[model samples]
Target chain A: MSVDVKTVKRVAHLARIAVSEDDAERMTGELNAILGFVEQLNEVDVSGVEPMTSVTPMEMKKRIDVVTDGNKAADIVANAPATDENFFLVPKVVE
Target chain B: MSDLTRLTISQARAKLHGKEITATEITEAYLSAIDRANPALNAYVAVTGDKARDMAKISDARLVKGEGGALEGIPLGIKDLFGTEGVHTQACSHVLDGFKPRYESTVTSNLWADGAVMLGKLNMDEFAMGSSNETSYYGPVINPWRRSRLDTVVMPTTHQGDGGFVSAGGTKTQRSLDNAQLVPGGSSGGSATAVSAFLCAGATATDTGGSIRQPAAFTGTVGIKPTYGRCSRWGIVAFASSLDQAGPIARDVRDAAILLKSMASVDPKDTTSVDRPVPDYEAAIGKPIKGMKVGIPKEYRVEGMPEEIEALWQKGIAWLKDAGAEIVDISLPHTKYALPAYYIVAPAEASSNLARYDGVRYGLRVPGKDIVEMYEKTRAAGFGREVKRRIMIGTYVLSAGYYDAYYLQAQKVRNLIKRDFENVFAAGVDVILTPATPSAAFGIADEDMAADPVKMYLNDIFTVTVNMAGLPGIAVPAGLDPKGLPLGLQLIGRPFEEETLFQTAAVIEQAAGTFQPEKWW
Candidate 1:
């Protein structure tokens, strides 16, 4: 199934990455190429086949859910473009 | 003194213990080599001179005290993907404008705990997405080894689908490849280039889908992607969570063994990190493969494969046979579907994993009217074209209407691919061998790759199957192509059986002998 320019734009929007008209048009062809490529999967007889969930089947190791470590709010926000008091600054969400 | 940069990890380890050379001396040698070669090769994106020497000094002290760790005194390069505690850890992407992680990745921490010295961060495909190094925000890394102008091979192209086969002596024969820049395959491109160029004793690299093995093969270096969860993914930048794995690209098989021994560990931090003890991989080297069942997967012999690659595969089979391996013809019938299935699964997970980069905490932030617009703008401006493309593909597949037809179907195909390998191994196949790449390193902006992205994805044709199964695979340099570029043979081992890969690869390394480029860089 090939993606139209509309589909490409929608996908890019859902992905939250901006794509200009030119890029979306280009991605239409590109994404279609990829979609066409992966279409080969239709040939496989997976009628009763289970989708793979994990590479290794192992019991999930759990630890005590208590706070093992913390108190480095500074380190967490150290690389943010804008921050105040270890709080990351972003465009105001609400008026 | 002789050029200390030429010493392999094993050789460097022995000399450090023998007191013939200090860690400081070896680090200096590699630093100087990197300084000279990096400008031309563009292998290392950052050179941590002070840190390397400081770490080397610590190693020297430990060696003197007879308390050195496994990788003591060995100077290594960290892939840009791995966080290196306050060092450059951007995954070679522009999105991470100035990211120096506060925390160290669990893999790099393990490396440091073993006394390995870090030379610097190497370049890679941004977010380890693309097959060629061309996708890096930092310009594509130039391979240290270039094709000789006088030497020529039948121009071979093995893309995918019906048109993959380019006729012999195809249109790619240009005037001179002697000076043309070839890519050390990505996303571990820089890791392979640095190790091959002798910029570091070895380099830490990762593989989601053949990142470690493809680059290593192109540059005539040795690289092994241990079983998924063999190395902790605690802090290595996540690409495709389920598929991403950490390993090493080193000068030779023994060095790869030495590095992996230190790199693998069980971590409480990464639930996926296997709890099994790391083997003395070095001890596995030189072990007899007399009774080992080396399976030659007949499905790997893809049509339109170059004569040299086919010949190299034959040579590998013969070498193992000579070393007393019982060669068995095997069938992994689902091999052709592996790469296409990977394109879906890897991207679907990548889109999810990359969602965390939306201008909130770290990395580039492009201001907009609102937070949502801000995220859209920042991600658009931040991520590279290939990254965006994969994100779009992933977003499309996981979208409401297409989820079942695309993503789920791909995952089911993944199960079939895994079953293919399982069936082979269950039948007493020790390790399956195949050609590492379709052709030797191609030009930087290869015509075929530029024309179609799927052509680029096909570069991992043989290697991707191993990752699909979560098994260990090693790429060892075998023979040189007609163009004088190195060709590599891949050995896919059973899960967590990296020792067997090391043992078998060492035999091929001995038979084919290791290759090094004529250093013009």
Candidate 2:
């Protein structure tokens, strides 16, 4: 299954990455080549195998619902490229 | 005392303890070495000289009081992936340009707590994505080791009767012609190069697939990627959550063991970090593996493996057998699918994790008329080519129409691959051994690998299975290839059993001896 230019453009949009016409054209070939390689997985019989999410078989550790750590808004926003006071400044999302 | 920068962690530790060398003196030696060599090697992206001195001063005070930590005053390099408080922690990507974390990563914090001084943040492949360090936005780190050249003068041929000398071969005589620049493999290439070139005593590195071990193999250093949850991944840049692990790239097996002991710890921040007691890994070194059952998987003997690697594998078998360890042949049928499955799972996780890098909160942000347009433009400009390719692949696979065929299929195949390891381990196989890489490191941006992305991904062939299975694996430099470049043998251990790997790898390291490149930088 080759990924066409239309699908490549759509995937780029879905990924929120702006792809130029030339980039989309090149991506069609690159994505297709990668897909062509990954298609080899179809040969393996994984009919009854359960999908694994964690490498170690353990439950997520649970604790009482309490605030363990926080209140360092200054630390969190220190690395923000655009910040106004304590709040991170971004392009206005609200109309 | 020939070069204080050449001291390994253990040697430096002893000297510092005995008061023969102060922490400040050793730190100055490494900083001077980095100053001299970093221009040619490009190993370090950021050198924290002031902080290193301050830390060393504190360590010196502790030594004066006759109280010091495990790695008292030892200088080391931190990989760009690990976040240092108020330091450069961009993971060598343009996306996180100028972003410095206010908090330190758990691994680095642990190392500092053990009295290890930070020399600098080392270079790496951007976001730890590429096999070679060529994908670094800061520029490819040229390895310090060049092919050894023989000192030969192409003397001009002239008869005694002739007054003037004439060249027999053309006048353009070549001296020291064999210094071809070889690549120190990635994504821990910087750590490997820094350790191999004596810029640092030991360096912190991370491995999602073969990042730690492969680079170690290429640069003739020792590295270990402990079990998935062995080290806390709290502040390290997340590549693939389940697969990513922090390890050490050091000068030898003993140094790697010492570093890993400090690096691994349970942290509340990263819930995946196990609560088990971090073992004394250094104690396991030089222990006899006399009756250990070492597994040799037939599946790793892939088609067209290099003759030297095959010979090296056989040589490893002989070394272990001679030491009274039993070698057993094993089969892992699902080995072939590990790479394909990993590409899917890693990208899927990367796409999700990288989604935070929009134009809103931090790092590089491009402006546009609308918010959506801003996100599109920011990501376009911020991410590199390989990163965008992974994002696109991830989005396509996880998209509504193709989720089952790609993402879910890959996950199920991942289970099968893990099961193959489980079966082998259940059969009482103490450890599994294979070549660290299918071949030694290739040239930076070599033509054959540059043509196709998958060709470069194939570099992880021998080491990815360990990651897929979530097992501890160590790479020990076993022999030199035909070009005199080092090749390594990988030892894979059961989950949370890094000590066994340390003990077994010592056997190979003992036989192979240590490999260091001739000084070219």
Candidate 3:
């Protein structure tokens, strides 16, 4: 679980952030520190312990399966940065 | 006229009903106050003066027609994280600098239906990432109470001191301090500051991991995070889907109740929203808390919590006891694991939620020679360092080979934490009492920022457990620290039992006495 500079670099790339070689070294150190602290959790005895999803014991409310969106495609797309006649426009992927 | 700023929401509503003052007058007063105070505090991302005035005019017409809602004509500040139709709803990030949703969030729509006037969009941490408002693209907000005359001498010693002194000492000090602004409690800091400064009556705020309550505590306001699904998240920008819940930030418990009632409803658009009937939250207001069972968790007494916070916690418990509530010692054995589990679960969800903002949607887009370049360059330039760091960490924790080790394990640990609370509640504990945070706000400096991020993450130790459990919690101003900054007492309630939480909070608020910061204006 040690986060090295290479792992840090890959993570940055995956996250779409540009990290310089110098900053990558620094980030690696910080990430390692965080992981080191998190490593403490390994010592606790959790055998037979149930993972909690919520503090309350109530079940999540189930909604009816239905599509009820108000047909506001034009309104929704009005906020998009770039749009075509009826769809969001982006750089050509197939070219 | 200035004294009107001191009136609570309930009192203001009474006056508006009695025809002693028009909604237009109240709206104008708050708009003027926001105009006068916002330049220094920077609490609002956008002020809706025209919208508020128009709403006020309508409210007056309703009054003339003998048709008014409970919160009619109350000016409200909507957090920028909540989508508003035709109003710029930037999430304190340059990426969405000019983006305005064509539809309003359900919470906003509810408030509008209740006749609440929109004051503006409040500022927040970019995408609600940071614990301090310094991460906001619009810059940090200053706590207004710190600007009061009585706080001037003691304030410089606290996190808010520098900004408070500089803003009041005129242009020279203001110019210098502007270069080195202090940190505002993040995510909901702007909402807290606006309420504390009397710039607005109350504001809408969201909490994924103590975002609303922590800031409200730091700024000495009252904030509540309702039970999950109690408030709709449809128009809210997603941070961590499971943990995110919207609530109200107000000057007192009554105001918080008023705002919460108007905003809570079952929304068809939000699949996660509860179908349960919305209650008359105000009906529970001022309800007696005598004979209630209050639990004091032993595990929340972390090692090296400031002595002041410990004293405040004890004082709050003592007050509840005096108010006819029985105090029982409870243990949340899984408390220590709560923080670690939350960091994992929250980030994993955030990584997935934020994937939609990859320069192809509504945010900033950098035109490049090709697709890959466009995605990389755009995101790299659009996001700030802290945001990038979080996104990277989140992505790593959820990636292949790491999922089982981190994300799944965290989920398992989260279950244990939830069970701990359940065990306590089953033993007749109605609510748990704890300190909202370990210490008061910290300074905004490289040294301060350079400290290990986990150390900063620990500040949410007492608050995060509630969110992890999907329970409702409120942060009420307990007392001031030695440095004269506010400290908050946290109240944790069982699932969807906010009525009990608010009643308990009111009893504590009454017993703890009122906080009166010295006025600068």
Candidate 4:
């Protein structure tokens, strides 16, 4: 319900963003405000109401389950920062 | 010929068909205008002159063979968010600075198939996260109309005027004066600017939360957000998947119609793309709105709304009434909850969609001592402040313990908002009319965005409901605010009912005497 600075910092970390202590404090405040605003939704009565997902009641269109990629590996990898042995190379994960 | 550059796509198509001008000439003219105006406006991230010329040559050959499509030889701008095969699609973020997709998006491919020439990729908010175009790594696009005539000759400020001046009056003033730079609106700000300044005839744009319409509104250009499934999302870099829809930003309704037709197509690769028939959007144009019920939602009249916007809404309603449209007062009681719901749902989806870009897949990656470090270093170095902030908030809402309270609850509310629209339309409200934004364009120096995200989010207030409802909405250039910047009136229609929306919009355009840039350009 209430997002504290610690929780905000944890969120920033999980999101892979670098936020300073001051920014964490600020984000906490903003998040609290947003939460406060969202809290208003709790006031509306919907005892028998169904939560709507889409305006139109149409179902998601079905597509073929087959997989036949164009196999443009070289083309797809052309934009990567670094590649080795036809694979994207990243820093070593294990020590 | 200079005047021809300001012509709508339909007008251009007619001229191209008649051989009054060659595709090469039109493409060259737009390229030359981009050359002249881009430096002042900063609208494009890259200008593909060679590709454009080559495409024009092909279009010319098609014309010679009598194989011209609707968009044949028409020059257009593609937003950087749409991946171009060889052209860089950076999402306006440094994180993917050199990231170019090996494939083209279905929408872009469709445009190319229709023989539309690419003027190059236009600027946008970094990863389409911000409402203002300011977050782009390429710097904000200055509205070309702002610069004075002398400024244009000397420093390219020839069209620069105060932020809110109407385009027609501003253009007249610009003609008499020296060079100055005017404000093109944001996200699709660059595209809108390019079209407004006659740098291009039209530009492709994406609307997540009014990115197309808001900028279109600010720049006095026509922008449409078609039904969500109408355009394929396969090649487009994801930004709030459920909400993002690629559309066109053009000078007029007919051009928007043409661009929409050119862009809409079914793609098997994008499962979300509809397999339904793509209609002749242009044929829907000029259809009579007589006896059509137009709803004016009283709930959209938020407190503290500027009187100017209200006056424009009243004037628009009156105009539609005189044109045989039945004006009905309606209520979307859940309208106020839309902004909050959108902020929650869009970011939540964005978080999931963007998770793939975690430094290893295919974007900018910073080498680090470890894999975890690689992600942190890469993301910290790559993403802009706004993007980072969004991802953080998004992750927070979707986290384990918070999921039910935030993410699930928001999803439930999203349904309520959607049903509100369904109820009204079922009640005989053909289309809903509201102000596109609470106010007009703000200054570049405005730091209020940092202080108040809610106020900033309110810019999408009128537009996001359409997205939430998955309905079609168009921002018509209604009138100007006191500051003289263009304010738009939004017409929202039922799902897949773009024809009705465009017809109603055309009536409003005719009645309002919508701003035409050619008269000024």
lDDT of 3 at B345: 81
Could you give candidate 2's per-residue lDDT for residues B24-142 as a string of tens digits?
Answer: 99999999999999999999999999999999999999998889899999999999999998889999988899988988999999999999999999999989988888888888887
Return the TM-score for each candidate structure: 0.95, 0.95, 0.92, 0.92
Ranking by lDDT: 1, 2, 3, 4
DockQ of each: 0.82, 0.79, 0.53, 0.57
Model 4 lDDT per residue over A1-95, tens place = 77888898888778876677888888888878777777776666655555555544557767667776867778767777788767988776566
Provide the TM-score of chain A alone for each candidate, in the order shown. Answer: 0.95, 0.91, 0.80, 0.78
What is the lDDT for B299 in model 1?
Answer: 91
Misplaced by over 4 Å in model 2 are B149-177
| Residue pairs clashing, model 3 | A51-B412, A51-B415, A52-B414, A52-B415, A55-B469, B155-B161
| Candidate 4 per-residue lDDT over residues B1-521, each given as its tens digit | 56668677888999999888889998888888878777767888899999999999999999988899878999888899998998989999888877877788898999998888998999888888777788899998876443123222222335655533334433423234223334455678888888777888999899988988998988888899998888888889998988889999888888898889889888877766777788888888788888999999999898999899999999999989988989998888888888887878888888778777767667778877777777877888888777776787789888989876777777777888887888998999888889888887776636777587676677888888888878889998987665456778999988888888788888888887666432233
Error of model 4, residue B244, in angstroms: 0.9
For candidate 3, write residues B1-521 as lDDT tens digits: 45566677888888888887888999989988888888888999899899899999999989767688988888889889999999979788887857888888999999999888899999888888877777889888876555211332322332444443444433222311112344557688898888888878899999988889888888889999999889999989998988999999998887898899889998877767777888777677678878889999999899998899999999998998888889999889989988887778887888788777767668788887777777777877787767776777789898889987777788888777888888999999898899998887666643745567787777688888988988999999989876667889999998889988888888878876657544454
Over B1-521, each residue of candidate 1 has an lDDT whose tens digit, in order, gives: 39998998888899998889999999999999999988898888999999999999999999999898888999999999999898988999989988999999988998999999999999999999987899999899988888875423355355322323344545233324488889999999999999998899999999999999999999999999999989999999999999999999999999999889888899999988778998899999989999899999899888999899999999999999999999999998999999999999999999999998998888899999888899999999999999999999999999998999999999999999999889988999999999999989999899989989999998999999888889999999998887889999999998999999999999999999999987887
State which candidate, 2 or 3, has the greater lDDT: 2
Every candidate's CA RMSD: 6.9, 4.5, 5.7, 5.1
| TM of chain B vs. native, candidate 3 | 0.92
- Give the per-residue Cα lDDT of candidate 2 at B430: 97
Clashing pairs in 2: none
Query: Number of the top candidate by lDDT?
Result: 1
Report fnat, model 2: 0.77
Candidate 4: regions farther than 4 A off? A46-56, B145-183, B516-521
